[model samples]
Target: MKKLLLVLAGLLLVGCQSGVELRHGYWVDLRHPAQGARPRIKVIVIHYTAEDFPTSLATLTDQQVSAHYLIPRQPPQRDGKGVIWQLVPEQDLAWHAGSSFWRGATRINDTSIGIELVNNGYRSTLTGREWQAFSPQQIASLSALVKEVAQRYGIRPENIVGHSDIAPQRKQDPGPRFPWQYLAQQGVGAWPDASRVQHFLAGQTPRARVPVEKIMDLLQRYGYPVTPEMTPGQQQTVIAAFQMHFRPADYRGLPDAETAAIAAALLEKYGAAE
Candidate 1:
């Protein structure tokens, strides 16, 4: 009876302390929270593992490369969730994106979550490069995972991007066939406004003609690695990257009417938001 009374007294004492909780015999104050200048996280960069599942696991686990999570192509049924294999802790910096930049942020691995998807990357063909299609099931799983991570980190939809979006010069994983539009429909990534695109696509633009400088400005506004000083070859790579994300039906890297329309729409929608 005396021990019971002492326990009640201790509970009463804790209940009286302002904004304090006695947890595991330790008093924790809830008033003060740790403050930081930049958000601990700001983006989620998705990738496609160039090799198969086993090779991907081996590579990501290797000291030379790493990622926060890995999703295999032939994922086991997960009752409707994405097949996620955690390779690194969320708090630790993963060496997945090498020499990456986006939205003025360099060395992106420091402030982003990397998700590596099991894929063949790309196939070299007689004509040029051929991209492999992702499984519907895998995409569904990825959609769910993307939503959860984005919500947890308060990451904007536009900030969820492919690795190639950050490093177009030497990287193109999560290629054009990756169905970014589907993810965008599910509210995971950014997609240009269809009405606005249709307006430009129908050749009913407000301007008499859109110039190369306008297209470049739109691409830059949408966060592509493009600049006025870039060489023609360098600019083409960035344009190809942009097309792969927004206008996958035609990604020849040339400034076509369709590409310009898509770029303008994206600029009006996402760039304005940013």
Candidate 2:
């Protein structure tokens, strides 16, 4: 009876503390956490669901694709704030980033948390396709969530990226209208300094031809998955991806002074430190 009482007391104490619990019909004292360990979550990948809340929820829960959290376009109010859904736990892996690479890390799903926002993505109109804009409420909720997760994992500002950033060729979710600059203002992601960009921009005109190889080198240094084997078209796709993130005004995939300058500024701010 004493032995059983001691085990029960230990279990009760452990339940009150932050530690791993085992359930093999007995409780083991494991409260001493290892100092050499760190969280596997190093990156936070933002995405757009490309569907309504119901459809996105259904697809994420039923299908193979999943994310750590989902913010609805019109989230239900709770406690005077919007409510977001958590589809997957942070400790587990979510298959959101498929065939992706960033900062020399491939299979990004292994070490990242994915956040999905409900959006229609884009609609085809008479003139052209119109991309959807994220709601202010959605962005607010996302900012809060991202701040919390980044704090928990000590994720860097540059590590907070969109789905298109890690997989440029095949994906473009959380697209041009995602307001990356706004997020950068909130200290969530990377943004090139305007002054530095202008400093580089001052050296050349809009039509000045910057070599494609030099631009590619700058992008690779800034953390895109550019490689030597990529053809001209593929290289353009990569450049377009970079522009989509930094220079959303035009993403023609062609090298220009502004593009090169922005790349250089980003490298100067983020890459040089690393």
Candidate 3:
């Protein structure tokens, strides 16, 4: 009887061991299966490292700064397996999107996944432009990553944003050359509807038709952190962030016909969707 009991206990242990996987350890509990909360990933915040590959890696890994993934500005490898590096696991939090706000969420690091791209940000001079453009390989990998993450976490299109979009006053990484339109075309993020933009623009003079208060209300309604009583400087910073995402052709931080049109279009589409 004792020998039989020992054999049965060993078999039960083997069955439990075979049924579960734990990192560098062994444990088993048959309480429940497929039981856990869904991934808490609510937003995907894109950024540029503003440095070379090696430097970016070191800063993101060694320094306090970190992200869920890092895509270097390099061609895809033969196997296409190493286009991106997952520095931090998806289940963990990364110290990116510092002191940022979006759509009533503040300090968004708590619910956002950050992806850092390799490139130098914009330079001061125009003739001697120093900002490097993101490569095709990088964008392709980014699209795949964004789609995969969004599907897994049920992240909405409008939730895919840049660091600049969250922290407009301080950061502008993944700048105008980040190929946002391409990502939108690939169904990675939200793009302004052309008809809505045209409707906002057609037969409209930009002198002073829409009151500033109305514009501010619409901007806030569209997820920007704009307040009516904001200082002029603060208002410009927020507007510039909007332009960087929507109307990259001009991010001068001043409201114009194009800016108004784009802003209204975004509000009409995503405001309703959200």
lDDT of each residue in 108-155, candidate 1, tens digit only: 899999998898978799998878888887787788888988898899
- List model 3 lDDT by residue over 1-274, tens digit each: 9999999688767776777433345556555666666667899999999888999999999768999999988745767654689999988889999998888888888899999998888777767555678988888888999999999999988899999888887888778778888899999998998888889888676433445565566678778777667897888788778887888777767767767787788877777323
Model 2 scores worst on lDDT over the 10 consecutive residues at 18-27
Question: In model 2, which runs have C-alpha deviations exceeding 4 angstroms?
Answer: 1-36, 272-274
State each candidate's clash count.
0, 0, 0
**Tens digit of lDDT per residue, candidate 2, span 1-274?**
9999999888777775856566677656578868999889999999998898889999999768999999999888899788999999999999999999898889999999999999989889999879999999999899888988999899988899989889999988888898899988997888999999999899688546688998898888888998999999988988988888998888878988889999898888887423
The lDDT of each candidate is 0.82, 0.89, 0.82
What residue runs in model 1 are displaced by over 4 Å at the alpha carbon?
A: 1-17, 20-29, 34-38, 79-82, 201-210, 272-274
lDDT of 2: 0.89
Candidate 3 residue 129 C-alpha distance from true site, Å? 6.1
Q: After superposition, how far is residue 233 of candidate 1 from its true place, in Å?
A: 0.6
**Top TM-score prediction, candidate number:** 2
lDDT-wise, the better of 1 and 2 is: 2
Give the per-residue Cα lDDT of candidate 2 at 184. Answer: 86
| TM-score for each model | 0.85, 0.88, 0.83
